[model samples]
Target: MTTQKALIVGASGGIGQNLVQYLSEQEAWKIVGLSRSQPPLKSTAQFIAVDLLKRDDVVTKLEKLTDITHIFYTAFYGGPTFSVPVAENLAMLTNVVEAIEPVAPLLERIVLIQGGKVYGRQIGPFKTPAKGFAEK
Candidate 1:
């Protein structure tokens, strides 16, 4: 049987580290961790330190990671402000997806883990109609 590989972005962070530990415990998965720094947890996961802010760097480093079955994106870029820039964050996310999609043919799913306060809640009611789930 072929080994299932999972990539955990921002593997050094709280959420990402836990994911690395959990996925590492599962015998079915081969975990590859990507972050700006190494995770503090003791894990068998293959860790790759890459700056997500730099699109070219991310592409260069992740391009060789073929046969990825899953991607858990927990990375965030706050830039120089107290809050992260929307455009920068969007660009980072887009860059990673574009870099990996072409090389990883076996890729099946990508999970983006949402953390911290829901800033969207401050934006007031949705301008568009809800597409999924009923609002309480």
Candidate 2:
């Protein structure tokens, strides 16, 4: 059977840490985790310290990963006032995508982890709880 490799960005975050733990338990996945902070010592996933804001650093580090198959993006930057900075947030995600795309030819899937902010619940106009999300 072919090996499945997963690259989890923001691997030190709450969701990212859980995902790394879950995927690591599956024997098929070769996990590669990236984040600015160091992962917990108990983490089995291979962790690489990286800052998405540094484009050159991101490229330098991620370019060496050639066999990645799946990407889980959970990185986020929460500014003050609970308002999501759309441009800054998009830039962070874009940096990862741009850096990885050129290096990961075997990449098959990309999963972006969005939250309630996308639905304008906690970041923008207050809408009915049931209201579906719309682009700002």
Each model's TM-score, in the order given? 0.81, 0.85
- Estimate the lDDT of model 2: 0.83
The 0-to-1 C-alpha lDDT of every candidate, in the order given, reads 0.81, 0.83
lDDT over C-alpha atoms for residue 105 of model 1: 97
Error of 2 at 41 (Å): 4.8
User: Pairs clashing in candidate 2?
Assistant: none
Model 1: per-residue lDDT, tens digit, 11-57?
Answer: 98778999999988888899999988886788889988887878999
| Residues 1-136, model 2: lDDT tens digits | 6889999998888788889999888888999999897788475688889878888988898998899999999887776866667777788889888988888899999999855555656655665554534443
True lDDT of residue 71, candidate 1: 93
Q: Over 4 Å off in model 1, which ranges?
A: 118-136
